[model samples]
Target: MEDYLEKIYELMHEKGYARVSDIASSLDVQPSSVTKMLQKLDENHYVTYEKYRGILLTARGQRLGKLMKERHHMLEEFLRMLGVSEETIHKDVEGIEHHVSPHTLQCLQALVLFFDDHPESLNDLHAYTEQFEMGSPTDTEGKSV
Candidate 1:
């Protein structure tokens, strides 16, 4: 449901409306599958769906979609900071976004803000990572030797 809402939100932003075929293509699913989901969403009041017409998100759906998009962006940024490859960031964010708890997400959000506010810290971490990868010795306390 969240995925559907998120895709619909993206389509609406990019194309001004979300047709069932558009959602199907975006999600790489069949139009029949999208229609079934849209029917469910309409029943749940998440979307206003009409046959042969585009869908409109309800307020509740819109809020959830915005939140899901933001969460995905935050996770992608954090993964990039960790030197994850672009493909991996995209794949991992999708898998991780749905599973993250509120508390964990808050921590990740803080980490992102910290890195943004203190770029020197990110640089230091990267430098430390390079040294560790090069077989630099470290003490029991994890400081470089």
Candidate 2:
């Protein structure tokens, strides 16, 4: 349901409207599935839908969609900062965005801000991660292995 809202929001934002076929293709689902989800979204007051017509997001849906998009981007950026692969970042963000709490997200946002304000810290993070990956972890006192 959330995925449907996000995709529909993206399509509507980009193309000014969302079609069942376009949503289906973007989500890799059947048109029938898109229709079912759209009906559900309509029921939930998230979208206004009619057969053979365009889909429009209600204000409620728009808010959630925008939030989901922002969360997705933030998670991606966070993972990218960790040197995560693009493919992994995409997969991980999808999983993490739905499960993260608002508080945790705020904390993550703060962490991102911290890194932005202290770029040397990010470099240190990278170096620390590389050391661990190389199987030379630091000791309790932060001494090199």
Candidate 3:
């Protein structure tokens, strides 16, 4: 359900249409998988599909997809700010965004906006992380007993 919605969102962003082949290729799944999911989404009123054509997200579906994409983008930006590697951000955000609570998402969004407004704050993050040893429980100021 969410997977199909997310795939459709990605396909729409990449191309104008949500073709079965496009969704399958993007998800690395079979065309049969995409067809089955599309049928379900159509039944659920999330999309409109026609045989041999492609699927179009309904207004509800489009809104949901856009929200999910925003969350993913926010999580990716937050992870990057934490010094996570670019190579890992895509997969990491994919896994984490779905499970993160709304409060966490809002916090992440705020952090992204904050850093965007103050790029120098990133240097502070680096310094804060460097202050803590691997197993230490020191405070933010890095003072250890």
Model 3 lDDT-worst window of ten: 131-140
Q: Give the candidate order by descending TM-score.
A: 2, 1, 3
With a 3 Å backbone cut-off (N, CA, C), the pairs that clash in candidate 2 are none
Candidate 2's displacement at residue 70, Å, is 0.3
Candidate 2 has what TM-score? 0.91
Candidate 3 per-residue lDDT over residues 5-116, each given as its tens digit:
9779878888777888878888889999888888888998889988797789999899888888878778887988898899999999878977888998898898899999
Residue 63 accuracy (lDDT) in model 1: 86
Residue by residue across 71-129, what tens digits does model 1's lDDT show? 88999999999888897898899899889898999999999999999999999888777
* Model 1 stretches astray by more than 4 angstroms: 136-145
Off by over 4 Å in 2: 139-145
The candidates, ranked best first by lDDT, are: 2, 1, 3
Flag clash pairs in model 3. none
TM-score per candidate: 0.90, 0.91, 0.85
- What does candidate 2's lDDT look like per residue over 1-145, in tens digits? 9889989889888998889999999989999999999899999999999988779999999999998888778888889999999988888888898898999999998898899899999999998898899988897698877
Instruction: For residue 121, give model 1's deviation from the true position in Å.
Output: 0.7
| Per-residue lDDT value at 42 in model 1 | 90
lDDT of 3 at 13: 82
